[model samples]
Target chain A: MTAPSQSPIYDRVALIGLGLIASSMGHAMKKWGLARSVAGHARTAETRAAALELGFCDEVFETAAEAAKGADLVVLAVPVGNMGALAEEIAPVLKPGATVTDVGSVKQAVIEAVAPHIPNGVNFIPGHPLAGTEHSGPRSGFATLFANRWVLLIPGEAAPDAVAKLRAYWEAMGAFVEEMDAAHHDLVLAVTSHTPHLIAYTMVGVADHLRRVTESEVIKYSAAGFRDFTRIAASDPTMWRDVFLTNREATLDILGRFTEELFMLQRAIRMGDGDMLHDYFTRTRAIRRGIIEAGQDTAAPDFGRSVTGAGE
Target chain B: MTAPSQSPIYDRVALIGLGLIASSMGHAMKKWGLARSVAGHARTAETRAAALELGFCDEVFETAAEAAKGADLVVLAVPVGNMGALAEEIAPVLKPGATVTDVGSVKQAVIEAVAPHIPNGVNFIPGHPLAGTEHSGPRSGFATLFANRWVLLIPGEAAPDAVAKLRAYWEAMGAFVEEMDAAHHDLVLAVTSHTPHLIAYTMVGVADHLRRVTESEVIKYSAAGFRDFTRIAASDPTMWRDVFLTNREATLDILGRFTEELFMLQRAIRMGDGDMLHDYFTRTRAIRRGIIEAGQDTAAPDFGRSVTGAGE
Candidate 1:
């Protein structure tokens, strides 16, 4: 924490739909003094009140239009389902030449939904900060939430300066920013985020049903591998729902591939072909190594800890 | 570190394989003073030397038959693939009244593979100590590895005394004992362990391939939900292979169900069905809470840290 120095990422930034991502941005902005002032809006009055109470913004507005009035940067932090509606609502009130972005999980659908509603003078950069936790709402944010996380911005090769500014804003917010095509972004996230989440939800559902039948306190014995699924399954419901609803095709495509492979492994298991399972498991370990080497994740030692220890 | 006591769990305990579970059991047995002596065998002489050098056992032998000689309790700690062979190898030298058990991930397979191979006078009770870390080898275990972890025993109604003795042995090794039929044990573990590990392997494979095609450091951005898969994927390959092969039917059954639910969620995402995704995500959170409450797992407050901040 240094003495706050003025940053030029944005002036009078307006956040529409103050949830996890938006509140996080506010925290980052306040921590770095990136924005001249921060104003936010939410559909529910309680959310707006909570945002202000949590000191996530300079002021809270009742409407997206009010929040966007004269702000140089307008961030739509609503769910994918509400992106188009919020874009339409703020179109009239957006300040001239203001750079508008979002933090939605789904990319292409958001582009199609939000692009049509942006005013011609305003820069529309469909964006997603690939940083969040299971917690949601305005109060569940902290300064380091976006630290070392990705913030993917899809500009469709339309505005490099606008994209650069947005990227810089994310960088200042402690996020690693990448410029990806909206369709590719959707496809990548489908495998990385969407399908994994759905699979987790399904597994937990199965476990729940098992609890009913076995009466064995199966959940009590969930330490081995099931706990990981439970954590993913515990993500923000509304945000995930919107992501799946908006990014259906990509998710289904990857999920189909996953099931095909899973079926092959299942067949091998059933046939007692230990070779297949062994080969697959061995190959998977290489990927884990690659991920760690590529700096995509922590080594096994620092996995759950911020500090390092031996592998065992 | 306490004075020696007369009532050791066994006069001499022979471990047929010195892998992660076995090594950990040795540590636990020493901590509890539950064994007069701990000795083990490895397939390779080099591994036996390494285990002995690492002080994992009082004596390390190169052959199962040699290890079982004069030992009152013989524990098969080999992979399910090697269980039958090891049982046959050790049967000739096993003491007349020795109790034989195992720490295989799959119970039914071990029972079918090893029970008939045991000598006529030796009592066999198939067991699984549901505790481990991703690391393997003799040096990667600790005395507390089985603490608070479940140890499933399948006695086949053979002898109450044998079951009681085995349960007491595991209890002395710091595990809570649970008894069930062999097939039921396989089914429960298929849901709780095997299927989860398979899914993790599949996902890591998907992410790795995706990374190669993208030519970007995908795993660096993996903190979102990918690291869990990596940890699970990094599990001992041969052991997991044996588990999948042995627990094939149940694993496939669960995989089919998981695939069905995954497809449903994928469809909902494609259809822009936010309601469906929200409902599924919310439901899964409850399962996570159930696990935490049951003390089967810790809450994901700090990315799966134990509540007490204690070592596993």
Candidate 2:
């Protein structure tokens, strides 16, 4: 029988990490009553306490297995490098018919690491939410973080009903859900997220190591273009490190292409090839227009950044 | 003589090339009464008409010379490549004791191109405003574009009074003004603006050229990191081309360093060096905090991007 419209989708949901994505999920689930009870586990006592204090979770556990016990759905929200160990830890306690999904940026590695440990009756779906801010941690999340975002699900070997249920849950959290294969999801994310974050980190590192440009000058004059790169680079270090480490092949492939293209532009600059530079830049500009038209980004000047406190 | 608080800084100010910077300056001047009469010139008649219709300028001229004649201050706001030609066109019409400035990105090149064309009694101070958006054109200007933004003035060979007067004018327009030499300005900008922009353009171009990732997917899932690069890459193509061409030496130097560092990061990723990646990412994260502390950028998550219309 179908439940009432206002009824919770799951009797109880377990979140294995109390980072940005998991905390935001907890908030969204609580705001919409998507789950009757939300339980959480974090690596450190401090994070567990923070999650409980934040009130996104009804209860917190010291161990992920304890959190997974009696849960209708278990969400793996840890860094990619820790996914396999966490999955092994929580496997014994996973309830039969419970669906397990992850919120990792990389998909294939997550599938490989988490799938083998899942029980036969339980569903193991790897999912990624294409949404985040530079900030992280339990306190950095809000209910609206995934409101307009896309959540990609990889339902390998999962029952049709299980897949549908997971999709419905994400939809309830204000995200548009799509089905994607793990390998393809990893490649798409490499181009869209992993490679771009690497470039941003590299650029920021370059700025920091510059002896001629003082640290203050780099910070003060960052409004031009460097500030945007810094924002991307400012993302949680451990999480990003795991992303790069686990998604090595795809990230390196994209990075190689990036360097090839960058060298071409560098040559154009050295050769004073204005037409080449102009044409390349014009092509890139068109892509930006496409993004704006797709409503993936705001067309407001400077991402609608307020000018307040800039003068003070 | 000190003018009253409400009085204009200049009797008549001429703005050459009615684009983003010029139109923004016009709006700021009008809003703050920084100038008694604002005159503007654009290469295209449509832009000239738009400037007049936008009401940022009191009058619009078809020729730079006509706009410069009898003006107390003249601003060369054209692209870097056009600065020399524009300066020559307006040189004969510059009034005695008047100060001429530019809003070019590359200072040394602008000085080299425009300095020789300056009339003996007229002051030519090369300046650059560290403010802009992904958009350009006469209509893209706003009164607060320069608010709290830094405007670096290279007041080489200009009289102290002329430099002070121009500083006061910029202050009235809501900008914090600083002075730097032409070579140092070009180098600093290359590190802070030029190199970062080139990298962004290259990243966007790579995304555009990818065969595996569909354009729709790249645009739709851009919220992760690529969207920021698109914003920086969407900046005016012609202006950016001129910047790379004119600031070739410094841009090349910084580009070399950037690639070197990028290769290091790439190698680390290839070797699965998580600690190295984490440390580098953490270091860059600190720089972003510094920028927010310096009031150069907002601390808002994702630049406080609104989630409205994101789902619809």
Best by lDDT: 2
lDDT of 2 by residue, B89-171 (tens): 88898999999999999988888888999989999888888878777899988887776678899988899999999999887
Best by DockQ, which number?
A: 2
Candidate 2 — number of clashing residue pairs? 0
- Candidate 1 accuracy as lDDT: 0.75
Candidate 2 ranges beyond 4 A from true positions: A1-5, A296-312, B1-5, B296-312
The TM-score, computed over Cα atoms with residue i paired to residue i, of candidate 2 is 0.93
DockQ of 2: 0.54
Clashing residue pairs in candidate 2 are none
lDDT of 1 by residue, B1-312 (tens): 122234787989998888777887787777778888988888888778877777768998777788899998988888788889888887888888788888888888788888888777788988887777767887777777776677888888467887898888877765678888888888888787778888888877777666423634345446556666677788788888878777777888888778777777767766766677677778877767665555534421222344211111
lDDT of 2 by residue, A1-312 (tens): 112238788999999999888998899888888999999999899999998888999999989999999999999998899999999998898899999999998888887887888888999988898777777889988886666567899988899998998888887776778897888888888988889888888888888898988997887777678777787788888888999888888988888899999999999999989999999988988998887776635432222222211100
